[model samples]
Target: MAAMAPSPGRGAHKHGVIALILCLLVLQREAWGLLCYCEGLCPDHNNFNGTCEAKPNSFCFSAVETVYDVETDQWKEERTYGCLGPDELGLMQCRAYLTKHQRPKNISCCNESDRCNEHLLPQIIHHKPSVAPQGNFLESLLLVTLPLGFVALLAVIMTVWFRYRQRESSMLEYNKPLGLVIGPNDTLSDLIEQSSGSGSGLPLLVQRTIAKQIQLVQSVGKGRYGEVWLGRWRGEKVAVKIFFTTDEASWVRETEIYQTVLLRHENILGFIAADIKGTGSLTQMLLITDYHQLGSLYDYLQNTTLNYFSMIRLSLSTSCGISHLHTEIFGTKGKPAIAHRDIKSKNILVKRNGECCIADFGLAVKYVSENNELDFGNNRKVGTRRYMAPEVLNETINMSCFESLKMADMYSFGLVLWEIVRRCASESGDRYLLADEYQLPYFDCVPPDPSFEDMHEVVCVRGVRPDIPLRWHYNEVLKTMSKVIQECWHANPAARLTALRVKKTLYKFHVSDGTKIV
Candidate 1:
């Protein structure tokens, strides 16, 4: 039988039915597409302001955040909602093994509804870890991270501009050369007082001027944090530490610590300027300070053998710096007690006059007795493993008590003093007996580049300390110095001598030895 042609009305009815079904399917897809409450949204239905629409191949995400109160050791909960971005290009490498996409541990993703995220149970968190990225994550992460970086840059610019403008306005009254000179006083602390009249350091105007005018001459040293360069500003030499963009937190923290009230001290490293320059990926954080040509105490000890007087002066100066940092100055313009968490020979710089100064404050922690607060700034860096105190190695140090931190520093200080004493020449009977060559603390007990577990075994579990030479016992000064080192590195932190006490004892030694203080 031959096929018959359909009537016009029938054909029209069939076409209308097909179009209606297509419209229903489109509406279903629109209903199912993931939409998330924008971040910072209260997640309350009645108070909804806006939402973030997930792009195709994405899901809505919700996260629970718990902010910590370091002072009180308390936590408070917060909520965040957003679209779960698609699998980054680098994440494609893990597709075969993993079914679920990577995200923050706290985040819960769903496609049920925009408010589905609200259904997630709030969990208390001390700290939130970022997603475990895989493959070429850095390359693929630029898409998401670049926007955050741009926002951070804008915030930094606004802060810098505000400081610049405020200082620029005051500059009309009086503009001094590089802030101030050392006048009659010989110390940089005097220079700071002459210029700003505060231990908070030079004015932002002076700092910016110095930063802008600085001419980096040669690379002096390089470390995990950054590179130190010998820079000059108007003929006066300065040390310019060039920090990578990744170390912004550490740089900012050190800058803040250096600017603390009454922070300037004769034995402390002088603060000159801190500036964030450049744009995009080329950003450089410059921390300018007074340059010491003699280099670090570690480098100095390696080449030169110190006499009894030189050792005393170095020890005295270093103790003074540590004491100043550990002591809290009270009043209207007061300074918090700071603990130099890392107190190795490398962190102490040698001045031209045979004195040493504490240089790095990146890992330093501040204690404010008024508020009962101990501020450990957001820095990922930790103390050197080789110099790690027993408490620190075993993870038994009390984070709340400031004294605990100070005691930990004393342990490291003991190690540094050991390094200094090792190179000291002591008079043995008729001839002078030169001390052993410079060696790091626990050199015999542990290997170079030790891990946390390795240090814990040697320092904490095994109960081993740097050996004291038998020759040190005969000389009066050397005997007293050995006792002080023993007291500083006591197995029990509570038994350790305070920085102030150590300073006093070292002063006594200097007086007994009949050597003048440097």
Candidate 2:
């Protein structure tokens, strides 16, 4: 038996030609319905003119007119205008000789004007009649293109997923090679051991050591930038101020002011160590100073009760400290007139000897230029809102608006005095016995509400001032205190008493008394 021989190239060519012919036939059939008819050859129903003439309806007017009578169903020689078949009649109403009839269908049946109205009618291509596909061409194209588009989208998603998985795998490999994983139970010291073996642990250990060395015993107070901690440095009690590293410029300025001032006065806090030059970030910088265990004026007021005389002595000590900062001349440059931008009870520290000292130079700025113009443009609002002067809140004027730094300091000093008086007058228990013997009233009169405006408005606008209570009015110590508070809180900064004047006034008040002022 023999196998039949396979066809050669000729047979495949013939098959290809046949397929091409079939495709052409399908395309031709699809396009055949678009052909138009020859001018006068179509049947009346199919032609525009024929349909209008036969119907004699409103739609016939625009069709070409041929004389035809409906009743006889015959052609006539008479000429008529705008008498198209029913299909075109509505379109031909504007042509000459077609007086638009009320009833468009009632046209002449014969020669007589209205005689031909009897019911004349006449009239209107099949190539392939192909129905175009149900959807639009663009929509058909979209349907054919959708599968490829979906495949492309799927490919992109898979590529992204694979890349992400690969990166995660790489990260896991990198982390796993470190051998022993430090668990949550492991302390920082344990992590230091693990990291040290890999040469990455030393830096971490150093940071931890530095942080540990500076222990925060208690939070003394907090300000905008950071908080102050009563800490110990090398076993010596110290005040450690940990400022936010973000405010590097402010920290720099503050450090510069301290370095420039040096540790001169007994009442001013002396700087022992500054972390400004430390290797760590600025935020980690620790400002170390001698810690006065007596705490701040505000804290002292909270802990101890004092008679009017003791209160007066405390006020005098605070005034002396401020006076030293403002008036004590240092070097040929003279004392760089430093203004304690923030002066409240919290910033003043009391010592064991009952002497008060001014601390917290974070907001302090030196008036370097002789003009006394404070470069406050670079500074953020620093003082407590309650203690802020009205002018400070408005910030419309510069430091020059006040005649001297002492004047501004005095304004704050008044508030501090009032706080002292309030706390002293409110004391009870054994402290009250001591207070009573001093010939001081148990309680000083409550001061009027303070305005957060300019000192002028506080004095002139409000016409209100901190008054001495009737009980203490005749008392010499109370009288002196009343006078001092009034002078410190005077309306005009110029009119306000100077820190030096306050110190002098307190000295005279103390010297005249038999009791020793602390």
Find the candidate with the highest lDDT and give its number. Answer: 1
TM-score of 1: 0.64
What's the residue-level lDDT of 202 in candidate 2? 25
User: In model 2, which range of ten residues has the least summed lDDT?
Assistant: 123-132
Off by over 4 Å in 1: 1-193, 279-281, 510-518
Residue 207 C-alpha lDDT in model 1: 74
lDDT for each residue of candidate 2 in 335-398, tens digit (9 for 90 to 100): 5657777788878888887788888766666654565555443456466644554445455435
| Over 4 Å off, model 2 | 1-218, 246-249, 276-282, 328-330, 369-377, 390-398, 401-404, 425-463, 511-518
lDDT of candidate 1 over 125-223, digit per residue (tens): 554324234433776798789999999999999999999998777764444544453344234444455675567777666577668878999999998
**Each prediction's Cα lDDT score?**
0.80, 0.56
